[model samples]
Target: MNTPPHFGTDTPRDLVGIGIGPCNLSLAALAHPLAELDAVFYEQRPRFDWHPGLLIDGARIQVPFLADLVTLADPTSPWTFLNYLRTHHRLYPFYFAERFHMQRAEYDTYCRWVADQLPGLHFRHQVDAVRWNPEHDVFEVDHTQLDTHGEAEALGRTHTRNVVLGIGTEPYIPDALRPLVDAPGVPVVHAADYLTHRDTLLTAGHITVVGSGQSGAEVFLDLLRHRPTGHEQLHWIGRTDAFAPMEYSKLGLEHFTPDYTRYFHALPENTRDRLTTAQWQLHKGIDATTLAAIHDELYHRTLGGGWPDTVLTPGVRVRTAGRIATTKIELHLEHIQQNTRTRLTTDAVVLATGHRERSLDRILVGLDPYIRRDNSERPRVDEHFRLVLDPSVTATGCNIYLQNAERHTHGVGAPDLGLAAWRAATILNTLTGKETYPLPTRTAFTTFGLERPQPRVPAARQAAPTLTPLVDRR
Candidate 1:
């Protein structure tokens, strides 16, 4: 096997991707087929680990398996769920199961398997910054490769015709718990790191989980199931009255459909902002299965003549969390209904708080003057998901596209797994003219050692195929 030469300053690549999350994974799969385009994805992790911490046992994806990274975008694409089943020899079992959704673990496994088959993906390469080289009409990416101890060893730089920002989301921690992060033995952790401390949390006499989303509920249930009898208690704290279920109606689920995203982008700016604020519960909410599990556990404990040490502190907000000692942490809670404040101590704190989109400022610092922002302070992107840059910088027919960074403009579907393959194809079509090459239907088959075949114009659509051009601010 030939090891691809290391990318450096002198060797200019067609594209350099900053992150290899599912979002960019889809892009890499699509770009691999375009022999004319040389692209590579730089991932910080040694290997792929998507939502590893929240892979609770028996937890299935809330979305259907059909909405996988590639299926919805390209059904015939090899990256489809069907291909995953076929490659794993589980096609018969999956068909017999007659299930549309799958366990979160299984989905993650599928993603990892696909990732392993894709080349030009540099693992353990963490990008530190991306600056636009106005003179050269390219991006200068600075990154460092980490060793086993997570220490940077090889410092390197690469220049690319364009850059795709798919850095994904950052775990959000509440302001109240910010202080506890530095305290000794505080055990203050976000839900993104739940698996790291699952055993410790299970052994703790008292555990408090803050947040009411899917992660929060999952953590609460996992703790309840794993804790030794009469040894530990779990408390679920949230701002909402109860675990709000995700909206899965035909029309509601449309929020994740491409057409809806287009509709959302066409709406007035004020209308889009209003929709996002009003529909926060739709995507940020928990699944019904998790809610039911909590309810069932409580009911079962009640039937056993006593309440298992569990409490749901809904409609309450944490005002502050501080370390009272090496072994305990104090939580100051404000009850919304009663208008009362109460103090509680816990052995450990699990912040089920969610995440926010990664900011582009971290990478494209030099191009900050060109990037536009929406009313909500997110990057303003066009329908094709390119950042609206200032007219001063020559775009060199090179476009900086975003994968998971356009939720505000594109709706909830922007960051979803369903749009992954479609977004990649969109970018590919935009970079290379419609007449350049036809897009292939199957995205999973092996081509030139790459996982997917190149995009080829269909015989029928060749004459009037849509043309997507690179953004030329010049």
Candidate 2:
């Protein structure tokens, strides 16, 4: 096979993406048909895998199938999920089954198919650092190729007119539970790795599921089904007041639309921070289906006129955790509503505490001095998804776009699958200065705030489809 053109030679590439997750993969798929664009994506893993650890057997993606890599931005694109089904010759079966939300494992498989066919994706290449070259007026990306054991075997560089970071997120282990996870003999594990340790966890006399999100509910439900009904010694607890269902009402979902993303970005930094904390249920709550399934499972177990030996408590926080001898875990707890404290010892604990956005500082350290920051010290991201770099850096005429890394600026939709294609299109539009993919003029009916004067260019409507001059890569 012929190798893709190498960057850093005679002419710089248009864009060099660092991390080939769904976000950048979307960008690559969308950018593929654009004739004037030249791009490459690098990933550290040997192959594409999205949330491999958390693809529990029957867990369905919250978003519908239309939220694929290219459909939302350009439904006609050949890379749509529907096309995947058609290509795999399962379109008729999919139609008969009538499942709008596909299973998590299936989605992971679909993503792998997309990644395999997409061009210019280099896996096993770890991007070590990115630096700006004032002389060449481009960004220099340093990377190391890894072998099977993940050790560096070769070094290379890429100079590009722009770069995109789609490094994605990391499993968030709270400070209180870190000791328990790191402690040798304990069976405490995050929900991200639940399937990997399922057998060992199920054999335990007692299992405690922590956190109240979808993963926690799914894990608890799975355990409920596997254990004997009469002796199911399971405990599920979290800091939330109750096992709350996610906000799935038609109107409530508008918060994820591009119109709302624009409105949210316009708010003051402090206001955005406050709103994120207040609107936890919008994205962090359990799906109604999963919640219902849990309730149904519990109800079925109670048909014998006796309650299953399962304990469920909410509004409870794990203050500390330790090993009880070498076989069990002891979790120190506190009640949020009432001034009460308690402790529980279990054979195993499953933490579904969720994930957090990874920091880009370590890789972008060389460009730190040239990067701009918000009041909270986070790199300021503009409406177009480009990092708000310093004037000096901007003067070099280079762009640094972000994917799934702008939650503070883009709101809950930052990591949402539904908005992935649209965000990718938006970044491409800004990069090539053209409407590479035509987007919808308006996506939501609700107006965010009428009082505040709107900008001349409405966020709801993108600029017209006019060809803009592209920056010469030479």
How would you encode candidate 1's per-residue C-alpha lDDT over 1-474 as one tens digit per residue?
Answer: 112337565757878888888888878776766788888788888888888988888888888898777665567667777899998799999999988889989989988887888888888888898777777777788888888788997888888877888999999987888888767685778999899878777667788999988888888888887875445477889988767887776656756665666667887788777887788777888887788887887677767576677788888899987887588999999988889999989888998889998767768777777777777766788888888776554347666789898877877777777667777777878777663324444443222123356799879877875789999899
Instruction: Give the distance in Å from residue 430's predicted Cα in candidate 1 to where it truly belongs.
Output: 1.3
Q: Which candidate is the best by lDDT?
A: 2
Instruction: Evaluate model 1: give its TM-score.
Output: 0.87
Query: Residue by residue across 294-354, what tens digits does model 2's lDDT show?
Result: 8899999889899989999999999998997799899999999996999999999999999
Per-prediction TM-score to the true structure, in the order listed: 0.87, 0.94
Q: Candidate 2: which stretches are off by over 4 Å?
A: 1-8, 451-474
Candidate 2 global lDDT: 0.89
Could you tell me the lDDT of residue 104 within candidate 2? 88
lDDT of candidates 1 onward, in order: 0.79, 0.89
Model 1 residue 348 CA deviation (Å) reads: 1.2
